[model samples]
Structure formats: C-alpha cells, structure tokens
Target: MSGADFIDARAQGRHDWARTLGTVALTVAGVAVVLVPTRLLVLPWLQANGADMPEPLRSGLLALMAGLIFTGAMAGLFLGVRLLHGRSVRSLVTTAPRLRWGQTLLGFGLSGLLVGGLGWLLDPGAVKPLAEVDPRILGFSAMAMLVGFSIQAPAEEVVFRGYLLQVARRVFRSGAAAVVLSVALFTLAHLGYGLESALFSLTSAIGLTVCVLLLGGLEFAMGAHVANNLVVAFLFQDLSDANAPSAAGVDWTELAANIVVMGVLVATAAVLARRRVSP
Candidate 1:
C-alpha cells in the first residue's frame, strides 16, 4: 500500500449514515460529559485552593484536572464506535490489526522538532514565566500537561480524523470529498478562534490528516497532534489564559510560520512513509 492509499479492508460494512451521525452525537456528548469534571468539579476546587496563586498556576491546575477527566472522550469514542458502528476500536485506530508504536513515536518526535524549532526561530523568547510557581506545583503541572495532552490530542484524532474521515469517505464515496468535509468540520469546530486562528487550525488539520492517511493509521497523526499541542501550549503557557489558549491575538507572521511547519511536517511524513514502504 502506498502513502496515498487509505481504504482500510477491515471497515467494509461499517460507515453508514446512522453510524456516522451517531459518532458525532456520541463524540459531542462524550466531550460534554468530560467537561463536567473540569467545569463543575475542578473549577471550584481550583478556585477555592488556588485563590492566592498567579493566573498561570490556577490555569495549570485547571488543565491538570481536566486532562484526567478528558480520558472519558476516548472511552466514549470506543463505545460509540462499537455500539453505533458495530465496529471494533481498532477500526478507527489503524489500518493494521493493531497500533504501531514506532510510527507513533516518529510522528511525535519529528513534528515536535519542526514545530518547536520554527516557533523558537520565528518568535524567540515568546514564553515567559507565568509566576514564581512552587517547585512541587511546577513539577506536578508538567506531568499533568503531558498526561492531559497525550489523551486529549489522541482522543480528538479518534473523533475527528478517525471517525469522521472514515464515515465521510463511505458516505460521499470520494476520497476528496471525505478529506474536504472532514477538514471543514474540523475547522468549523474551532470557530471560537476567529479567522486567523481558524486558518491556523485548518492548516494543522490538513497536515495531521495527511499524516494519518499517509501512515495508513492514527498513531502517527495522534502523536503529531499531541506534540503540536504540547509545543504551542507549554511554550505559551504564561502568555495567555489557559482557559482561552487562543485569547491572545493571532499574529500573521506566526500564523504563516505555523502553516509552513504543518506543511513541511506533512510532506516529511509522506516522504518517510514512501521510503519505508517501497525502499
């Protein structure tokens, strides 16, 4: 199979209208359920305990707790895929029978190198210390971020690229149609980001989707997605409200740089996949 080929032999009878629509409903419901902890459970706790902390620390606390809760989305995704689509979780995960650990790591490391390198080169020293965080809090928060983003990003890929793309391709009966609609839906989900931020996200969605399609699975894309989020979030931790990562105005130059990074990332993944497959 070549990088451009993505029709999984395992998903033959899976993607009908009902299941596709159900995936959306279930995915959204899953997110809403997961938010319960962050909004209802963690918010009060953080507010009560972190009253004296700097905005960044409180924000970090919110993310830490939320990350733990966000694992629900992955569960919900699997459940919906099973109940609604009558398919195994593996259908939405990889073209292969099981997950590919090596590709996942490759995607994570390569995308991180490109994105973090470009970001630092273009806007050096953009991040500043949010506050004089306690050593314990800082250490814990770092781990929390890794845990949270790891689950959060992959869960998102399962819903967006995995579930959505597969269903759309089945429904529309065109790879182009599936790709465009999936990318469009992903872009629309980030309407809160405004035009520039939406554009940035759109570009990113395309890149990650390309990575998934090329690698014939979600492992690499999930890893790339997580790495992308990590660089953007951590480097800019103190620059903006954690609650609103896009609250800070988007800069055109930064947007341009991000697009380039995403584009290069996609291209690199394609090249890497081709080399491994044919050579």
Candidate 2:
C-alpha cells in the first residue's frame, strides 16, 4: 500500500475528530505525568548517588531512566487507539496483515552503515574506541543502551510517523500537508536542544517521514531511528558531556553530511520498497 492507501485504511475504524483530539490530549497528559514526577523525585536521588558509580554506568542509567518514561506515552497511545478509535494498535503500524520485519532489519543495517561510516569519515576523532573503557563497565553500559533505546526509538516512531501522521492525513486530507505538519511537530519537540540540533532533527524527520510514506509502514522508520541513536550514543563522542562542543554550535560540514546521509537513506528505502512490489 502507498501512503494514501495507508491513510485511507483509517476509514476502516472510528477516526472522527473527537477521538483524534482525545487521543492527543490523553497522550500529552500521560507523558507529562511520567516526566514531572521523575524529574522532581527520581532525578535528584540519582544525581546524589550517581557520583559513586562508574562514569559509563552513570550515563547508561540516566539514558535508561529517560527512555523508560516513554512507556507511559506508549500505553496512552495504545489505549486511545483501542478504546477511543475502536481499532487495534496494529492499524497504527501498517496496512499489511503483519509487519515487514525484513524491511525493519534492512533499514537498521543500512542506516547504521551510512551514519556510522559517514560520521567517522567526516570526523575521525569523533568516533570512540571500545578499548578505551573497562570491559565490564562497557558491557553493562552497552546493555543499558540496547534496552533503553530499543524502547525509546520505537515509541517515538509510534507517536510521530504512526499515530500523528495518520491523524494529520485524516485532518488535512493531503499527504504532503500531513508530512510537512508531522515533520514540523517532530522538529519542534526537539527545539530545546538548540537550533543546530533542531536543524539536524528536521533533516532526520523529513527522511523518516519519506520512508514511512514510501514503504507504507512504521517498521523501517523505527529501525532507522534505533540504529541512528545507538550508533551516535555508542560510537560517537558523548554529546551530553560538559566538555563536548555546544549543541548550539553550527558546523556547516557536519550539517551538509547529515543532509547527504538522510537523502541517501530515503533513496535506499524507496528503491527497496519498489523492488518488493515489482514482479
């Protein structure tokens, strides 16, 4: 199915304006509830005790905590889709009977190669070596990242490319408009990171949205997001480190590289999707 076909599938369920608005409101409340208490109560405790932990472990724990908060949002989305919209959560994922796992895995492999390879090629010093860290600590941190990002990335795709995209398509009645609105909202959500970060996010959102429309599902976008986060977090120097370059800093070379990578990934997805449907 194409993007229009995917959106048209919404007609199979109760996709009235009231239900769509309710889902959005409920999802926002769910995220706020998770974030507020965690920031107020849990983060301080972690900060106080985090000094005793190894640096890698401390960072990993923080990532895990942040990722876990999205569980509430995912729950709210699922509930809203099932109860309010009277549809299965699968409807938010794909028009097919089952998710195309091959596409998901392919997306991960291709994105991991492109991002990691181009990142190292563009700035060799940015890539971290595994041998620099203690083996045990590295192992634990890797595990934390794997679990945390696995949850976090897919949950995000579910919200933006999945639910929000469908809702936008229904409301706007135009695929191009829906894509633009979804990408804009996705970039806005990351604006706190700074203008440079938001620009990269805008590039990423456009590529991911293109993949969703071309491939007609969330799987590829979900996999690509997970790979992008994992590669950046594990291989590249820590962006969150106090000593690292400011997120606000503009590097034209890096920005250009990001655009190139996103363009290539979208093209790759388009080719693969076409091949799948070809005789």
Candidate 3:
C-alpha cells in the first residue's frame, strides 16, 4: 500500500500493543543474532577470512546495537499498522506517489543552500576537501554508504514515528507527547554518531518530531531522511569531518529559515490531517 493510504488507515483509530510488542521481540532476536554471533564455528570462519578481530568485532557490536534499535522500531510500527488495519500507524514498507518534483527539489535545494550557506558564513575554514579518492574507491564507498543508509532509514522510521510514537499516542491520547518520545528515542539511537553529531542529531530530532506532528505521518520524515543521507553520501565526499568546527552561536539566518519553512509545512500538514481524520 502507498504511504498516503497507510496514513489514512492509521488515522482511523488507536494501535494495538500486543502485535507491536511481538514485532519488537522478533526484531530484538534479530539484533541478538547479529551482535552475539552464536555458533562457535562462526568466529573461526571470520578469522580465516581475515576479519579483524578487534575492528570487526567492535563494528559488529555497534551494528548489533543499531540493528536492535531499528528492529524494535520496525516491529512496533508494523504491529501497530497490522492491528489498526493501517489506521493508527504508518507503513515504512510503502512508498507514496512521487511528491511533486518541483516541490521536492525546492525543499531539498532550500535546505541544502541554507545549511551550506550557514557553514560558509559561520565556518568558512571548513569547506570540504576536493575529493581526491581513486574513482574505484569512491564508487565503492558511495555504494557501501548507500546500502547502509537504505537498510537503516526505513527501519528507523518504522520504529520511531511508526511504532513507538503510535503506541505513545494511544497511551497519552496526545500527539505532542508521542512526538517528544519519538524524538528522544531517535536521539538516543544516534549515540553511535559521536558527541557532536549526536548533539546535532538531537536538534535535528526535535526538528523532525515537530515535522511529524505538523506533517501528519512518517512519509515526510522518510523523504527528509533520504534526502539527508543522499547528500552526505553522494554530494559531500568526507565522512571524517562531517561536523566541522562552527561559530560559537547558532546560525540565526539558517535557523530562522529552517524554522519558518518547517513550521509552515507542519502547520499545513497538521491542518490537512486534522480535516481528514476528523468528522
């Protein structure tokens, strides 16, 4: 089903905790498998393949942690959707009719320009290095990043806004509380992003929660998330310096623009969702 259809279904009533919990449990199981590496045979095989014990083991641990989070989120979201017949939770497995190309481009363009502009003004020294990587390595790196993000983003959306927020909404009977919890969980999930990105992720998380409340469903968040990953993976070449040093205070210009644009979008979406869901 399409994202719009999923949202419409979820808006009908409340979500079910039992199905949601089942989903969470299954996801947890999956994460455990990835993290713990059950069979004694598995470690020997990895060692034979030249997998760095310390690095691969460390990476696997981190991956396991991240995978667990996404798994829980996915389970919760789908459980809610299944229970509510798509009424109380959105579907991350679905896609919407393409947003108007112009509108989508405009949104992305504006956000990038604002962020880049702010970087230029507040941290001029941080202009990214002219990417000098070998073409093959660059291609491979891009592919790897794309694959990682593709698997991760939907999993995250389903868990955070789709399942957890939906369940919270049922409990609180308030949109704001659910959004807050979702944002907090989302921030916690980014613990692997390091201190700076985690901090920015929290800010971004708040922005996203507001986006959800205003925009009415997970679709918008998914789009924004994809757009962000695409930029980091394809457009900007460096991963090491993703967060360059910045000026002491927030960039008012970029911050203001982001607030205004997102605020307007959210307000419009919330109004529309209200109209659709209300009698």
Question: Among these predicted structures, which one has the highest lDDT?
Answer: 2
lDDT of 3 by residue, 1-279 (tens): 322333333455544666556656766765565546533444456446534322222233323334444554455445545554344232332223333344334334544554555445655665544255455644554455445544566567666766666567666776667767878888887755345545656666776555555444555555555455544434432433334554454445545544544554455445545654677
Model 2 has an lDDT value of 0.80
Predicted candidate 2 versus true structure: per-residue lDDT over 84-167, tens digit per residue: 988889878887789889888887888889889889999998777667789999999878877877888889888888888888
lDDT of each: 0.71, 0.80, 0.51
Per TM-score, the best of the predicted structures is 2
The count of residue-pair clashes in candidate 1 stands at: 0
Off by over 4 Å in 1: 2-9, 47-51, 54-56, 65-69, 130-132, 238-250
Full candidate order by TM-score, most accurate first: 2, 1, 3
List the candidate 2 regions with Cα displacement exceeding 4 Å. Answer: 49-55, 237-248
lDDT of 1 by residue, 30-138 (tens): 7788787577876777667776775445545555555656676676667777887787778677777668888789878987887778887876777546456667766
The list of candidate 3 runs beyond 4 A from truth reads 1-17, 35-117, 120-130, 191-198, 233-279
- Candidate ranking (lDDT, best to worst): 2, 1, 3
